[model samples]
Structures are given as structure tokens and as C-alpha cells.
Target: MMDDFLTVIALIISLNAVICLYRAAVGPTTQDRVLGVNIVGTKALVVVVLVTFIQTESFFLDVALVYALLLFVVTVAVSRYLEAEGWKEVA
Candidate 1:
């Protein structure tokens, strides 16, 4: 019963991630796009953690931790790159 509940919650989080994907793709501003991507990554991390619980596996938790670190690095890199662009507008 708890497994079923976790599965349902994971599915809901996945759906939310998909919805955030649209914002990542269609956001009007670069900052908004970055935020959307970060949100999606966060949701994915949550799903991975949920899977770890559902499957009673310890490896998935490690994978989730690595993925979360990767997500943070990428988001910071992109945000810094954008910031360093210094008010330049893409034509």
C-alpha cells in the first residue's frame, strides 16, 4: 500500500516535470528558462529518490545524489555564463 502511494506520488511529480519542460522551452526570458530547467531537474531528482524507496535499492540513492550534483553544476554554469554575457542581446 505504501509502495502504491509512493508510485502515485512519483508519477505526479513526473507529470509536473513535463509541464515545467514547456516553460523551459518557451520562456520569454533567459532567466525564466534557467529557472524552469532547474525546477525540472529538481523534480527528476525527487523521482529518483522515490524510486530508491519503492525498489528498496541503495544504488538509486547514490545515482540521485550524483544527478543532483550534476544538475546544480549545470545550472550554475549556465547562469554564470548568461551573467557574464554582460547585457548583450541575441539578435
Candidate 2:
């Protein structure tokens, strides 16, 4: 019963990720695309955690944590670069 619920949740997350991919592909601006990518990463992280529970493997949780950290760092770096570039354009 619990496994079935987790499977459904994971499937929903995967569907949302696909929608995010669409947004990333044709987002109106760079910021929109970045936001989409960030959201997709978040969804991926959730899916990973769900998988950990479904499979009863603790190692996947660790992998999810590492992936979350990487996602955070990458999003910050990209946003900072975009901000600097935007400032340059304004100046």
C-alpha cells in the first residue's frame, strides 16, 4: 500500500519535471529558463528521495543529498553570473 502511494507520487513528480523541461526550452527570458531548471532539479531531488524509500536503500538518500547541494550551488552561480551580465548591460 505504501509502496503504491510512493510510486504514484514519484510518477507525478516525473510528469512535473517534463513540464519544467518545456518551460526551460522556451522560456521567455534567461531568468525564466533558470527558474524552470531549478524547479526541475528540485523535483528530481524529491523523486530520488522517494526512490530511496521505495527501494529501502539508504545510499540513494545520500546521493539525493549530494545532488541537492550541487543543484543549489549551480543555481546560485548561474543566477549570479546572469545578474552581473544584466548589470553590465545596464551600465
lDDT of 2 by residue, 1-91 (tens): 9999999999998998998899888887888889999999999999999999999999999999999999999999999898774354321
lDDT of 1 by residue, 9-90 (tens): 9999999999999998988888889999999999999999999999999999999999999999999999888988457755
Model 2 misplaced regions, further than 4 Å: 86-91
Score residue 39 of candidate 1 by CA lDDT: 98
Model 2 residue 44 lDDT? 96
User: What's the lDDT for all of these models?
Assistant: 0.93, 0.92
User: On a 0 to 100 scale, what is the lDDT of residue 68 in model 1?
Assistant: 91
> Candidate 2, 24: how far from true, in Å?
0.7
lDDT of 1 at 40: 97
Model 1 steric clash pairs: none
- Could you tell me how far off, in angstroms, the CA of residue 17 lies in candidate 2 after the best superposition? 1.1
